[model samples]
Target: MDAHTVTRIGSHDKDLQELFCDYVPQVFRRADFRRWRAWGQWSDDYHAYALMEAGRVVANTSVMRMRLVLEGREVTGYQLGAVGCLPSHRGRGLARVAMNAALDACGDAPVLLFANPTVRQFYPRFGFQPQRQTLFTTTYDSVPEGPPALTLNLDDEEVRAGLVALSSEGLPSTERFGARGYATVASWPVANGFARPLRQLGSEAWVFAGVEGETLYLDDVFAREPFDLRAWIPRLIDRPIRAIRFGFTPERYWPGAVEAGEDTEADLFVRNLQLSPEAHRFPIMAHT
Candidate 1:
């Protein structure tokens, strides 16, 4: 076998699709190529590295640009996700090569990611430290009281579009849409194989829910006035749901004024290549 050649590439090209198909089976049990394409479409902060053997892609990883706001200030950082290597290429340091290239390209920005529990120890080798632990919160009885007067449809394209638009406004940091600035939250379900659910409350606001089995995952729950848990809680009450799991920030709104426990901390980590005086001054979540 010839030595693998690793190269940095743009996410907007066909090579990305080839990389996805080559390693989808090893990366996700249920990979949605359409959603992945959507992700690339909405992502503004994407840096991808591919490992090729004999001109065929065998491993891939990406560092998406993200924005984080803290103390009324915005900062630029990188969120590491979509890291994978083909099974045939594993244990050959292909991941390390791809990651090093990514880090080199990142310059001085702080890097962060939610590592799978299995690979927790692996990231530390690259100087990633565990900064926080997150939680998945759900409520069966928290639904607001109503007679189901409002129509609930999870498959409406308009609803999804609304949710996507709201995400950019409400949660700017996590929004991944438009060009190479950030990836829009709207593309999650289509990319991740999760079903999107829409809840409309008289045009006041809309919430998009992604369902995986009995668990309903809320991705970019957009609503004005802090969202009334009572109104939407009832939406899931009668359903055969085991629970509702929200990503990252659940404390923002979940009915009954539930506080996001300390367990839900965003684990901040860093991998420095060329640290500068202003590197530490850059807001951690600005570009996340």
Candidate 2:
């Protein structure tokens, strides 16, 4: 094996893109790579660092600036994402190298991230601890009963606006909206492998379902009221769907709507980031 020298570079740098093009394919499919690209646009607001050995990328990490409105004031913070390390370079501490570079650039703003189950234990070395658990709710038997009708369409522009609106309503403290939110919703139609005419329930409610294999994934549902889970539950159950998966809706927001089940906690995990006293912060909105 050849000895490798690791170098950290910024994502905005031209060489980083070349290295990303080279290394992304080695780890993700074309579609996944594109999704990451979309996220990069928003995630890039803070800064990105990549670990390179000779001319090839071995690891990568990014930090995005965020503002949260907490307790009636705004707080600035950082959200971390786009973390990866090539398999061949896993054991060489390249991930640590990339993260340290990002932290140095971040200069002590509170940082946050939602980690995969596999890597939950890996982030604590950098002063991260479990803060909160994200919950997912699905209902099969008790769908919405005569809820207000909504016309739901998956237009890129509408989806973008919907997300921005949701962010404003939910995360009023944040000063910037990153591309990850837009890209995730924009790529939903194709990535989840389903295409259907926009579904309209009424004037104020709309639902879009993403079907993969045998499961129907409710990618996004829009409604006028934040507490109107009843309206959208029927939209999902109306279909001949075997199962449904919704992401990042905590119990506090929905109250008694989310019935506890085995997969009820499917999205449950501890967030390891905290907000600094100086930065304005608000409740984290789960939008993926």
Which segments of candidate 2 are over 4 A away from where they belong?
1-15, 28-31, 35-46, 68-74, 131-140, 143-158, 169-227, 240-246, 249-253, 258-288
lDDT per residue as tens, model 2, 4-66: 334444445655666665776575444233443443432444355777667777777766665
Q: Show where candidate 1 strays beyond 4 Å.
A: 1-4, 38-42, 136-161, 171-186, 210-220, 224-227, 239-246, 254-288
For model 1 the TM-score comes to 0.69
lDDT (tens digit, per residue) of candidate 1 on 223-274? 5355564456555443456567654344345433233353423344455422
List per-prediction Cα lDDT, in the order shown. Answer: 0.53, 0.48
**Model 1 lowest lDDT segment of ten:** 278-287
RMSD of each: 6.6, 6.9
